[model samples]
Target: MTSRMKPAIDIIDQRVRHAMRQVTGIEDCSAIVTPATNAKFGDYQANGAMALAKKMKTNPRKLAEQVIEKLDVSDVCQPPEIAGPGFINLRLKPEFVIESLRQMHSDPARLSIPPAEKPRKTVVDYSSPNIAKQMHVGHLRSTILGDAICRMLEFMNHKVIRQNHIGDWGTQFGKVILALWHVCMAIDVHKKSYFKNDFERLQSNKDNKNELYKICMQIRDRHDKDYINDQLEEFGDAKKYFGRFLEKLDDIIDEIWPDILLAYRFVNLLDDILPGMGLRIITREKKDNEWKPVERPYEHLTRKITVMLQQGGEENCQEEDAWHSVKKATMEHCDYIYQLLNVTLEHPRDSRGESFYKDMLAGVVEDLQKQGLAVDSDGAVCVFPEGFKNKEGDPLPFIIKKSDGAYLYATTDLAALRYRVDELKARRIIYVTDSRQKLHFDMLFAVARKAGWARDDVELSHVTFGSVLGEDGTPLKTRSGENIKLRELLDEAIGRARSVVEQKNPDLSEDQKQQIAKAVGIGAVKYADYSNNRTSDYIFSFDKMLAMDGNTAPYMQYAYARIKSIQRKAEKSGVDVEAELKDLTGIEFTQPDEIALAKYLIRYGEAVEMALADYRPNFLTNYLYELTQKFSGFYTNCPVIKAPPDSRRQRLLLCELTAGVIKHCLRELLGIEVVEQM
Candidate 1:
């Protein structure tokens, strides 16, 4: 393989820092080289001498002159000049600029960008959708942002392990299984859509408690009857009926996937209202060598089922089968979303959910107890990591195991951390979650380090982002105040984009229009999220995102498509664009626009490095937007096909490089596609 090319800014920074080290006799002196604010001064300016002189208590201007005497950038830059206040201004030589562009043109795969000097195995955990639930608007930022982080790191030659820590275990599954059983019972025994009707009824009557209580009572009565009748059937247990239902679970999954959310909500409503209603239900438990009958409160049914599922064995085979079926259905839903969004999470490979670490929870608690880091607090096993306090001025507990013998999210996260460190051999682990979980991760990292599960050298980062708000400055939701489903949101975006494409270029073929619509629609949503700072909340607007002008995806896509059009036109006019670019020896920068675009083109690697440094995609987007504007200027002022014979190849070369950079950054790094024609 060819060697990677070091970025120009990095080279300049190293040279200036080396010169500073020689002048001050400091082993670790830094030259903070940044892009010049004004092009009149220079392309880049180093502002380190002033700070160093102050630290050493010497003349700033004299210090800059001493550093310049030792600076040797003759290969890339012109003579370095000391500007006001000991600032060193340096401009790239024309030959150096031409050589950089030539190198980038030759290396199309990576744009001649070098990998990191120290590549490490990095684990990024993101897009953790719960089992038996549809992903909503809340999951948008983490999913795309985390995917971009992985792409950039991998492009920089790091071994990236993508973890989809889905919520597949715990009390939720019991309710889900119960909901599934209700679906089966409604279809098979009652020959009616009982839960579907009850779901709507509950929603409509939720405000009237008396009517809601009446509905809950009616549902509980039927539930109790079904429970008793199944146990007293010819098979002598509920297994035969549920087992037969599980045989055709796939067909049922397709039928109920759309209604699973409704059924789940119905169960939750019942669980909340059926309590303290003095209702009872019959259940079975094994005693000695026979099945014995037991009665429990109606509301406690789901919890009992949860315990049964957690304690896996031959008798609980029905629950196990149901759990697997539910998980399979839920993941299929999530996989569709991932594919739709162009995300890189593959099912069963990148998916290591909470259930994967179930067996290790006990061992984690036991080890913490042995290490004197865990103790019983209010009947729960807790570890009070230092520096966290409650409002009452007491050390807050990081509860691992609850008083009811249930493991919390903290326990699973700790187990996951240990696995990533020891098994995956990850030197750095990033958790891409919302800002609300900042305190949780803070305590998690502290507890992990205190328990020696995460070594000091291991880098643990909680990459938090702000929420996507509606026009009203609140979290985006449907008219019913429910989380908007991700699938529906994306579909609406594509639908809206289709209309725009139809109006703009109605004569295009249907297939072409569809492709453009998909690209523009999906790219717009992703680019809008990426353009904003991850730490600041921004209002989500389809109108703003889909506009044809201003820092939007449609604008960027259109820019790339325009360049492609120019190339095609050149080909039709008997211009062998490929041969010209390949045979080109050097590029002459005669116009101001040409020089401006060329200078910015060589700094593509700098943009990638800055984005990777802070795990922010906005930095990359900002660079691309600026590049597009510069290219626009060049295209308007310096015509490509109409240029003179000598300048033709240089203009074409600029177009090729501009298109190449935009496509790589958008499609490869950001997981957003660009249309060849729009």
Candidate 2:
């Protein structure tokens, strides 16, 4: 089979293609084969005749019947029937459906899905939060959605690059640097006053020349020592690698002045790394009147991170190692998202941000200008391309420089693009960003094409998405004027998830609660964003997402959980699932719900392929939700426990298969967890 054609899929395609050719005498008519909008009809339906009815000079019902007479789908489907208003309803043979599911089960990949014909290298930019700030709700949607997109693309065999693109450098850095400088200055002033007069008076009261000399020497020695430089370098190396330990130090002699001050400064700065860098600081006040201790801000921050990371809800680790563990723990957290989402991630590359490209930005601009694709207008370099116009009907330019000759976002983006295309030899550059920057991206893609940095074969696409709005219909927010933080939002979601799981499945142990919370919380948030059309804005709704019915993550998860519960009972009873798989039988799909459920399950590969082509998870999400609903109806109507052995085995197998499909879809499409019970 060609990569595009699976056995069952090809059978359906051939049936439609043949019907179009025979009835319309036109081979290229657009024929849509979709699940029946309402399940009252057969398993699948094609509405190709509705549009063709006008052109063919015949009634839609008559044309559909004529088309159905010429169609051949015996290999994978029952003969087509003409339904109401020109709909070609299709029914799959139950034995055939069972065989298709069996074939999918036998395949190691579980869906019989194949990779793209031409897999190309692609770059995905996502989850780019600024350093030293908490990762807030402002960043949550993009991080989860973009990561899931990249994961899906890679899972389908594309060479994907995950770019964190942290905002490590900017004018903001200058602000932070100024902040740190003032803090250091104040601490130094306090240290100087404590040492000068206080030490001299202590020495005067002692009164022997030798004792005074010793005191002077001790004070002199203390002021000249430095241990912080060694500590900083050690911290950097440990965080970078997954190593057991950095070399430990034994106590040498005690010193008083310089060492203490230097250590204090380093500790103060390290406290800022908590929310993002994954570190904690703990401190206690000094009882001595002359020596006041620093407050334990780091410890509090570490506790917050620890609560998120530790399985048992404990926030205890070695102070020196807690920083490294938190960093490791954050990565573990990111990985759980990947696992739940069922996508692979590239080894993360820390290339920093726009300022990291400073050395190359100027050169890129010069090259664009030299190629005649860019020009200086009002002291700013811009690219004017064809067809794009402003509201005033003037040609719009993608700015590379501002009026002050400062580099702009477009320029940095172009430089990054050029580096990826020319230097990295990338075949594709897929940018995943918010849809508001559509014009910016369109301009960049056009200018890059004009500048000879990219070609049509080297794909450059901006996978733009809509804003995540709140219930108020603007953008999401708390009652507070400030933008809701990602960390805070996640915490709230997890807290709610914990309560939901506890109430629903109170029998789960503490460990299960923690694990399920991570899955449910993150899954609910991700599914809320991904389940809708990505190009359109979706209002964020916690209650709706966590609800037990209709196109929600929990509903999908609950389906899987119910199936798992059945499978577990079967296993406990020592039922031989594989041995129960039998060959020939009377095709027994009497119920419409059974037929509907079977049809949805068989289209698994097609849904994945559609999602892969469009880079839209909603396609798959919609498919899975329908599949779950159909299964739910089937389960309610068809009793499994009281059925005969052969039928019970078949039902169990069907349940097992449905669960597998749901698990795969949830991870691949929405990045959620499947609770065994709930």
Candidate 3:
């Protein structure tokens, strides 16, 4: 394997630290080399000498001079200068900058950056959407953020396993299956549009309790009748209607998503309203190999069905089939959003949902019990990981199984963690979720460690992010206070971008405009999110994100397009631009803008390292934004296409390298598309 190239800053830090070790006869001293705070100081500064002086109780400036005597950075930086308080300021030589640029230009794929020295098998769990529900704005952060992390890790040559831990099993699936049955009966049996009509009516009359109650009663009565009648069929409705419906489900799968959503709402409405209305529904249970009818409260039907699905027998095959169909359809919908966002999550391959660990939940709880880490607390199986407490100053219980014999998220997560570690051999497991789940994961990791499921050497991280807020500083939602569906949000972004593209460059072809619009629209959304501190809430503003200025995606993308335009213009004027850059022997920087841009270009690796250090993408975004600003200064101050013959090739090289870095960062690392034209 080829050795990875260390960043210029890393090389400098090594050299400076070695010099410090030689001067003070102390090993393991870090130079703490950082970029110069002010441009006038130099490109970088070593502040370790002052700290070392403090440790040695000596004059700082005098210690700095001694360290500089042993520093041999003449090959990379000019002679080091001692600044105030013993800061060692170093400036990169022009030859060094040129050589770095040449290395980047020669290797367009990686830009001369190599993989890590020791790579580990890593698993990233993110974008976990529930079965039978459309992905909403709430999932946007985890989906894209996790994808970016995976891309960065893969770029560093780590063994990355992208796990889409979808919510495929739970109490919710029972309701989802019930909703599917309603859809089937509404279309195949009654042959009416009751689900859609009732959903709209329920929404409009939600504030009117009397009217809502009346509607719910009417729907409840019909549902009861249908349930009783369906059970009359041989082998119940499980084999009669639902099984056949599942057989041809794919034929109308695309058309049923809307119906399924409406039906789900219908079921939820009934569950909320008909609870205390003295409603009863007839369901069945198989006892002694004979079917027996039982009366149950209408509102609790879904829960009863959930118990049946969990118990899983020959009698509940229909419920199991329905569960599978719903999960499949939901993931198919999620895949569409994944493609639109350029995320890498796919079904079956990367998707390992809660259902995958359904059988293991009991074993997880049992093993914890055997280890004495889990105990019965208030009739529920719980693990009281140390340091977690409630407001009453009692140890908070991390509930694994409810008193009703139902496993919760904590149980499923434990199973998944064990599988990732023991089966997948993952050295590091990262769970990307919102900040609200911090306590859950803290206890989870603690319990896993206590149970010896995840060893101390195995790295487990819960990467949390703040919610995306609307202009009102609340979580982003629709006007109706519903979670905004991601598909609709992305489509609106592209639509708005199209209008902007139309206003800016109307002469472009329709296809060209569309391509640019999609790139700009989606890129703006992802970039805006990535540019913000992951732990801070940011307002989702399409107008600001789409603006052609500042640190937005449009600005960075436009910077890239402008560079490509320069190359195109050069090519049109009978200039063999590639040939000229390839034939160049050396670059002499005569302009301040050239030097500034060249210096920032070589620090791309440092930016990557910083971003990866804390798993904060804002660092890399901040770097790209500054690089674009530097390139703008260079472009304005020094003309690339019309420069004098002696400097034209140098300027052209700078433009090419700038474009390459921007494209690689945006398209490859950030998963955002870059266009060649506005």
Candidate 4:
């Protein structure tokens, strides 16, 4: 199936394995073929022979020689070499390298990253932002990394289902909804920007410890009064007004969306500061089989709302209505962020938040219990998957249902895994999240395997990434130690890029400058992240990312733009680049630079294979960076426009292929936009 489009490494691996079978009479043999660790050894090195020899009790070098005796890779590679420890080094013949490029050049649509022979339904769960908070700097890595993975997988013809898995249903919603009620009351009855004033004061005094404490105390006092007075409803009082306000919530949405988010943050901050504050808020309870006022603990108020909303019924109509309204508005907020980030996540379509799996949480616990995979531990439904234990040396419980009958993330996640398998028919689920969730996912996969929800054929992976740190080696945050909003971070990046663009190319039209800045700025942020090791913490530096000299988005964009400018120059000088290469006979690797560039250019598909094999974008980025570096050497050594017709045509082919590779890696695979000018 992959005879035409299989990557170079795959082709080599197959040939080596086939030859190994002929030599050793083994039906299947591991080739362990990989790109050579160093170019001097050759283009590829087959290290599997050593392990196979150890297994069969044969000398590895002897085995390598025997395998080479029958290996039929001469059409593609030079004569294989036996190196140290029986390493069989294979270098492609120049003709094969040139032929590979010709294939990619002829079909720019694929860029040689052909569709997978056997496509699988893959679910990539990522960027699960909390509904109560704005998207922050902490969310940057997962969002972009996840997007790139989805892009790369989809490019390879995998049916990728992007699940946002947003944090929509939880006790946090209680805080936000309760806070929202105050926002409704403050404006409707008090006729004042109640939280607005306190919010401003808090922000203004965020750094002054004593002043901040005083402001917080005052705000808490007012908050207490507002929450308490709602129960003192004398027909025209706060409770009745709350009911009327909920009725009109749809109309006041636009006016309250911004303030509601701030108020929600205020509630979260207050909840953090005042621990075990047994204070209660007024809400409705079913008494005499009718809804009536009831007081609940401030801390548990969020829980009440969550339970009520999750257990949807006529009794919890108001609670459900309120949640739906807030959830809808939050979707708008997330949609705005997605648009600003150039992300492909659609609002409701891609969003399969925790709430979406609410109804299935209980059934998940029940089914696991029925299958003898889940049991009650301390009144909580738990699956004690093997290989996990607590500090007490007891098996750790993956609590699906808490003692209070409330479901945790584990329950919803299990439900999601099942849905993706049974309904979505997903053969692989790639979870993109921070490293902190590593233990959780390990337990999750273990439980799924134990329950037989995911079969042996189904792939479950936790693509964990490290934090995006500041230059100080701490998590990037605002001056007040709060999370820096993703919007502000991206806006600042674009602005910084704008200054660079205007300064470097003031002659570019204003629209063009903005377009370039947007590309450079956003591309810089994404590329900087992509260029780093995904499993290691990386410091986010605007200056470093926006710099034109380093392995950054701007650098890559500028390099691409430089090559594009050459094409423009060529056309302006009446030289058609396409025509020069359209009927070109052959490429001449005259100079060392030309040969090096050509060698790297022909390995584009190999780079794609490596990156997608392990789901690492950095490999692809590294390849593009090296390709550009090699092209720089080639551009300096080999004159395209001024050289003789033969050399000029060869250089032009390099330019065209190099440009195509960069554009594919950046725009197609990484979701990064490129510019035609710096």
Candidate 5:
């Protein structure tokens, strides 16, 4: 007898293309079909003909008929037919689907997603949380999204470089340093207060120190604003010239530094001078003797300011220039968070704030100016892209060089961009940041394009994402309105998972709970983050995620455990499953459920290939979930253990395949390990 088999996907594709040529009057017309959204509609559906019909100004049903007649896929599929409105439905031959499965089982990297025609280096910049300040929900989306994209691209045979563009340099460091040095009174204070401290003590210290420094900083900043307001008051008669006076003050400050410098005492100068808005520094660093000016009084002013920000200032200097001081502070409570939550990250790069970029700014500005992409606006250098608009819908510029020669995020990004493309030779650069910066990226891309740095050979993409919201649909925040810390959130998840694990399996030792809780909790959270499409927002919910039911990590994990359980039972019974597939030519799927389960068991490579094509791991997640469910159905409907010896071994082989697929899916999707037992 001649053996019957299924045609591979490529064969079907070619036959469909050939049929299109023979049946359609228009020789150039072709169709691409996708799996039907609903199984009731048939295995595959092609709406391409209807779409073409719209463009050709013809009847869609007639067009679908022509395409179906031209299609030559009789070997792999039944003849296509026009369905509702104009969709062409295709039912694949079962023999072909089954043969494809057998081939996949024998091949190593199974469903063989072809390599890129010409590969290019891709740099993924993500997980860029700032140092010192605790990571919050803001960092969660980017870190997870970036990691997922990198994982997908790598699986598809792309060279992916991972970059943790940590906020190592920035003003927040200045605040923490100044706060820690001064408010805590001594460098040793950090160790003394933080060591062995409980969460409450840490929380109290962080709140107190941040609030205290903020109030003092506020006094100076408010004083400056008041000074600006007083100037405005004096121009009441010339109200229309209000902007002119503000402009004059902006210009005068540069030329009249001494007058402004002397107006405040040295201590007050430090408070005002260090970068920050309310209670923060723009960026702070150790009081370095090398960077300080060698002139008289300027040295004394810098030192005194440093002390005021670091080791609490003498109470007598409230009148000092606010701009002359640097205050250092630490989020003392963050230590407790790390302890309670049980997660640690490498120390962030030593970036205090904007001041860290001060030197780099000059190089970036000069480059932009030389490239003719930036022009001086007022006193600052700026780059305005073509279509960006201001509040009045007038064209606005992206401020790269501040009029006072100050550098902002735009300038820093340009420097970073240059470093990425030039030093790294990254043909593709993907920035995983908040969607709120859409306009910023657009202008940045335009600037790069205009500067001739981003050519057809080099590509820049913004993988933007939506916010993580609370149960109430607002940004997830603490009760006191502070953004919840990322470390704290993760810790709570682990703790909750520990509780669940202990309740479920009380026989487990303390060490097991510790290890398993990390997996379960972290897996649940990461899976929740990833299972959703990256561009949409999802609510932060532990309870919903932890329940190992209906599309969850635990559900997939449990399915893997079930297979391991069966494997153990087979071993105990001396079933000898190893020799089962040696000559598997006569394997039979006698039960309806067995045949159905076998179908899913054999399609792992196809699911993975689909996910690789779209860069979405949710496809993998859903696939594993359904595979597990099918296995459950098979177990209930078919008696594997009591079957004839050969049949039992065949079923055991199926279980082994299930375990492998589950483990692969979890490890690839959420970076979780599968356990043989609960």
Candidate 6:
């Protein structure tokens, strides 16, 4: 007696393989058993005979018949049919399907899908938004996609380490630090509108380069004068006061994220206005038991700050404090988004971003150079990985370091790769990012492979996804052409769902309405993205995803709700669903709908395995959609509560299993929530 339900496909696959091996004397023969391409063929088609016959230089149909002569699937499948070109098709016996389902009902936790025979540790890198910046629509695919991959892998018993390789370090972050400094000044001594005024001026003059440059320089001057005047002694002090303020930043993160965003934007505006304009800011450095003033260029201030923060010392105390402060605020923002999206990227543990690799970057490059994989190109340290070339056919260089000593993203990525391999013991590393970064990852992976950073057996995959587009079929953006904020999009989704809920089912309580609206809204958004082929661009449509029909999340959720509602009605009308399903030994399916639903329900594991193999969630979503449709048909044909004794037990079991499968698919696997009621 098996402890868990074994999928009928697996049984048929094994039986067919045994039969083929017995006849052919090929002990290690494979039965390429897959779900039939279409229903006309059968439930599963074993195409291994064709491949074996081709390999053995024999007639395929002859080989199929020879293998079929010894095939003993009498208990599980009907007589095997050798279709065109030795395709051995096997259809499950109705009793076998019912028995397989009975086995599944014994253990509900695993849902009949056994853990992988050999599990490996996997590192899933995804959902990496920049620090001090609001998450945008661009992060939608990677976050949920990566999370789903993790869920699937973990479900398969693999040790999954989720790495949210966020853009928390680099030039943008340096600018964010500068912005935080302004926040510090504004809070401590300057007028409340000081940053506000500068930010507005910066925004207004964005198009006028000359005007923007002038304003940036003026802002820099004002900042310099303010630092000088902010003195406790005759010679003004900058670092001492700033360091103290940094220490107290944690208490104010909630109050200042909006300001942080504005300040970060201001930094971008400044960088835009003056591409390489030289300006300087004073930071405090303690030497010989004295607090002394140290100056860094305005253009390179952030870089210098980043290096110091990365390097970690008494000189970088304030910068480190500010860095941690900014990270805390940004993580809080991301947590909200994660909660809304149902992603499981936990903080502190799963999050290892670019900043985490900052210190190791130089070492990664140094090791590559030592191994002769990286070499000096012009003035930058570069690895010209083979097969990559420019439009002119020149060997493209993956620059690790600039002549000015700044580390590139390639350097940090390489560092992260090495860390994942060595420390995490990751046998497989999956990077989830936009398709635009495909080339970068290609170069990075090639360089890592050349440098012996990754083992030969290790699987390094970059799961690239396409962009989310708007109604006009362009990348999703606001009317002002700015990237749509994720938070705003979520709010709009919920608002739209509320409107829908009001129109569709207005009698529910306010709390129930809100609950349904949130589940439907967010689920719709995620399902729309999941339903898309990750490699193809998709138009994000609220009306379409939110529709309570088709292959949408709302549709799946509503179907689950309908099942639960029926179950509730069954109980209310004196039907003991649990008792009826307490024993599945005598269950019988009289209706075609029941048979179809049972067949589809058992394929859930197959869907999970397929999605995990390709990192494609659509495979799972498509399976769920089909399963729900099957359930709908079954619900219509066989009544659970009102059916005759022979049918009622079987129908109730189907309802329970359908609801379980839907919940697992939506909430557990895809990170989409479902409500009990509409």
What TM-score goes with each of the models?
0.96, 0.73, 0.95, 0.93, 0.73, 0.91
Candidate 2 segments exceeding 4 Å error:
1-10, 18-27, 49-70, 83-87, 169-173, 179-347, 350-352, 582-587
Give one digit per residue, the lDDT tens place, for model 1 in 527-554.
9999999998989999999998889899
Checking candidate 3 for backbone clashes, the offending pairs are none
Q: What is the C-alpha lDDT of each candidate?
A: 0.89, 0.63, 0.88, 0.83, 0.60, 0.84
- Mark the regions of model 3 whose C-alpha exceeds 4 Å error after superposition: 1-4, 55-58, 205-215, 233-240, 272-280, 286-290
Ranking by lDDT: 1, 3, 6, 4, 2, 5
Model 6 poorest ten-residue lDDT run: 232-241
| Candidate 1 structure lDDT | 0.89
* lDDT (tens digit, per residue) of candidate 4 on 319-402: 566677787887787788787677788889999998888889889989999999899898888999999999999999999988
Q: What lDDT would candidate 2 get against the real structure?
A: 0.63
Candidate order by decreasing TM-score: 1, 3, 4, 6, 5, 2
Position 280, candidate 1: lDDT: 75
Model 5, runs deviating above 4 Å = 1-32, 59-62, 74-86, 107-117, 187-361, 509-511, 588-592, 601-614, 645-650
Write down the TM-score for model 3.
0.95
Which residue runs does candidate 1 get wrong by more than 4 Å?
A: 1-3, 232-237, 271-299
lDDT of 5 by residue, 28-59 (tens): 65466566777677667776677667877988
How accurate locally is residue 42 in candidate 6, as Cα lDDT from 0 to 100? 85
Candidate achieving the largest lDDT: 1
